[model samples]
Target: MHESKLIIAGGSGFLGQVLARYFKTLGWEVIVFTRSPQANRVAREVQWHGETVSQWTRELEGATAIVNLCGRTVDCRYTTKNREEIMDSRMKPTRTLGEAIARCKNPPSVWLNASTATIYRHTHGPAWNESGEIGATPEAKDEFSVEVARAWEETFNTTATAHTRKVALRTAMVLGDGPNSVFPVLLRLARLGLGGRMGSGRQFVSWIHEADFCRAIEHVIARAEFSGPVNIAAPNPLTNAEMMHLFRGLVGMPFGLPASEWMLEVGAFFLRTETELIIKSRRVVPGRLLASGFQFQFERMPDALRELRMRMTGDVKCTLPLPAI
Candidate 1:
């Protein structure tokens, strides 16, 4: 019997690479659709423009699963040109894929589209779940990020794919070992003695380990009942201060200096990124996943950070030395 095939659109980035490798290890033939096709890639690569339909659409004809992670990174300054590209990057590829799938004689059974926790309103109190309300408005400063997510998901949901089960993954900051991941950024700050709370330190940081992220994607693929938007985040949400403190402990650092909102704004300007990435309270929870009995491997910040440290440093036995819970 032939192994099942999985097609990943925009599978060139950090998360996409991780997912591609993951499903491939499970005996699935992974096909990656990327802009810059590398000669050294393990998975079969198909060059794509991301905006228009082409021969790449044929890869979707008889695939087991299709995952689209083609959005432009939201880590840079929200310039007018950048904002337009950000929206278009996500919207165009999503719509194009939907159209391709609809035209397929044997469309993939599941289609998991990338969305973000930023789609939820910035909240500090209650944890926003999959059923949470959409938070971005045209007048909001961080409206660009929210709008991009909204439009990406809307394109996925509205596009007619009767044979395919669609699931919008409202993911959070994924903590992993890769250089492009958020882990290295925080680790650098901690090593420089600046791994402290940002602004008021009360902003909630909803996150998930990379392992859990891959697992959740597989879980959704297996469970036919899970459709529409699903929160792919750890159930426990921590404040910015608490998360940083744990990161410090994981790296064996004792202390870090806190940054005020004004300081954050200045640093962001110099770094050419937005302070909204740090200041916004992303208090999201995987209510649907937990309710559906999806158990998280690393539910706590300490556990997740420790796992990341092991992967980075290759010291498997370096346990957490902090005080007990």
Candidate 2:
């Protein structure tokens, strides 16, 4: 993949930084598009300040792939302005790239954009696959995510996807060996004896380790057969209660309290975030990826938890090592 330029729209972000390291190792000339003035000097990163798509629309020349990871952090409080920002952050960049591809003389062959499994309904039991139903009407979901997914996919399909071999990654919670993951927050809560399941602990968590996440993207880049929306998550999705139980065992702490749904709602309101982020149950399985013969490094709950804890504490007491993706 050396000098096989891959343009990352939000290359300076948390997941973007992880991808930067991975692609650099694979020898892909990574170009991170950011508005930050200091972003240009950051090794292997280049500045892309244009938001209107007219500027340097031709710069994507000779690119083999374009991975779009741009989006406003959805965990923050979602005010009217914040919601608009969230929608625009994702929709605009996608539209920008789509328009660029439509007009480019030499465009990228592949386009992989970031999406979430949260687009699915809150199902405690019913499982979803790649061929599952995608709701045309926005059901009882928060305003931000409701409109955002529609606009995003619309732009990707109508604009960029038409010109390129596009793949939308409907990713679940991605765990990695860094502070950017939700592991620290959960770990800290457990250490303080405040850790337990959120809400009823019935919601399923479909997760992928950072290594596998990167590997999956690489696979998509190499395979032209994978197009459309692919579920970039682990097949085994444990219930929130079971996941918390594993955390308690790994951290060697007692489960203190289960976060109440009402409390979560109140907190979401206060935090300016959508409570659906906490309460929504997504039991998504990687049917397509598995069918495509993708192998998982850490497929089980206890194993993923144990290794994640060790990486965080810098203390290796167990025999199990980090699983290779």
Candidate 3:
């Protein structure tokens, strides 16, 4: 019997590290392709420039699965240089991976590429599924973000890799205990009584717990029917106001202050981040995942937040058993 192997490109980041640990515990050999290979890494690291093909192409030859999470963090302000870096970081890696897979004698069974739920148009009306409207709204100030998402998917879709099963993971804001994750930032705000609604607070925030995110990825890899653009978000997406309210309650805080649009803009300028990340309405739902009968362990925000709080406080261990694939 051959041992299962999983190769993750750009696996040095937070999400990549999460997947590496999760899959490793499930008895699969994990290989991480990183620009900087550290000796104390969780998985075997292979150095490779994300844009070009090199000796690292050999790692994809007979792997069980390949997950591409290569992209620059979008947490900073969208300056001219940052925009170019963001687009190139995603497009080059996706194109390079596809080219490498085409050269493989035995390509990985499945290729899961990272995408964003922000691809959907900003909406306060109905929730967006896989077939939702994918345009930028002027109010959300998401023109550049939508442009990036469209190009990222287009690069992956146009890549010619017939033998490998491809799936674009339109992942939502994943809540986890990682230092770079959004959960801690929000938790800190809630504790400081600054956890309040921003810009009228009508925008919907779509998110998923880190555990369910891994499970959904496993489901996508195991299920043959899951292909194309699959939304990896929780079914229930609440309003920003509601989410902040929940956060305040979870942290045992009362009387939090609300921030207007101007306030958010000022804060964003100081923080060197964009307000679109907070103000955009991303009511994305996992239509494909749900239709395929995949269940989320943390469907509701309250449950997910409680679990994260427990883990943060050291009341619960982070070791989550992998669901049967």
Candidate 4:
């Protein structure tokens, strides 16, 4: 029997590496398409400048699935140059992949493109499903992010790929133990007694555990009914204050120093990142996945945080080696 091949574009990042390691353990031949191919990387690496068709296009033929996680990290300050790169990075790769898949003799059955949960308007009232309202709110400071997401999905929706089913993964913040992931940073802050609520602390944080994230992707890939925009977040979205309280408890910290909106803005400027990332209320939920009978291993925030904490402290052993980011 021939082995199934999985291609991940921009697979050197935190989420990409997680997916690569998980799929590899499931007996899939994982190939990472990256601009910087390293010999010591976790999976096989293929080089491709994201916007153009190259020799890497051949790998798309006869592949089981192609996951496009290609996008500039939104962790930096949103300058004019950074804004342009951020928008271009997402749209160009999506457009290029569509072209490649269209030309392939045997294109992958499914294409999962990365999108963001920040596309939804800021709301503390109710959780947002796939069909939720999408727009920017001045309070969230997510205008640029919403613009980027809208253009990115628009490009993917307009692209014509006759044989492949496409799914836009409108993912929230993914919690993992990787250095590049948010988990370690938050954990470190908790340990330092700084894991307090930021701004008003009422902003809802939508998140998913790394394990469930991988499982959710696999679930979507196997189910043909899943198409268009799908929310990849846990069902129980908690407030920023609530999440930080959990973190403080997990770390055995009695007190945490809270940062006001102005303090957050000042800190963000020094950190070279935007405050919108932390302040936005992303109350996204996986409606299609749940409606289709997909069960999440780590559904709630407390369970997910405890599991990650245990793994970090060596209380629980991981089955697979950590993938290099």
Error of 1 at 139 (Å): 12
Note the Cα lDDT for every prediction shown.
0.87, 0.76, 0.91, 0.91
Overall local distance difference test of candidate 4? 0.91
Q: List the candidate 3 regions with Cα displacement exceeding 4 Å.
A: 315-325
Clashing pairs in 3: none
- True-structure Cα RMSD, model 3: 4.2
TM-score for predicted model 4 compared with the true structure? 0.96
Candidate 1 overall lDDT versus native:
0.87
Cα error, candidate 3, residue 183 (Å): 0.3
Per-residue CA lDDT of model 2 for 1-325, tens digit only, reads: 3368888878787788888788888887877877773544333555565367766565587788989998888887777888888888888888777877888888888999888776666566567888665552333354457567767877777773455799989898987766567777777777787678888887778888887889999998999899988888887888877777666666678555788878878877886667767666778888888998999887775677777767767778844322222
Each prediction's TM-score versus the true structure: 0.96, 0.90, 0.96, 0.96
Q: Count the backbone clashes (under 3 Å) in each candidate.
A: 0, 2, 0, 0
58: Cα error in model 3, Å: 0.6
List candidate 4 stretches off by more than 4 Å: 316-325
What lDDT score goes with residue 5 in model 1?
Answer: 89
Candidate 1 per-residue C-alpha lDDT over 1-325 given as tens digits, one digit per residue, 9 for 90 to 100 = 8688888898988998888889989989999999999978768899998878889888898888999999888889988998888888998999999888989999999999999998998876688888787876332255777877888888889999999999999999998887579998898898789999989988888999999999999999989999999999998888888888877877778899999988998999999999889888888999889988898999887888888888778888867754332
lDDT of 2: 0.76
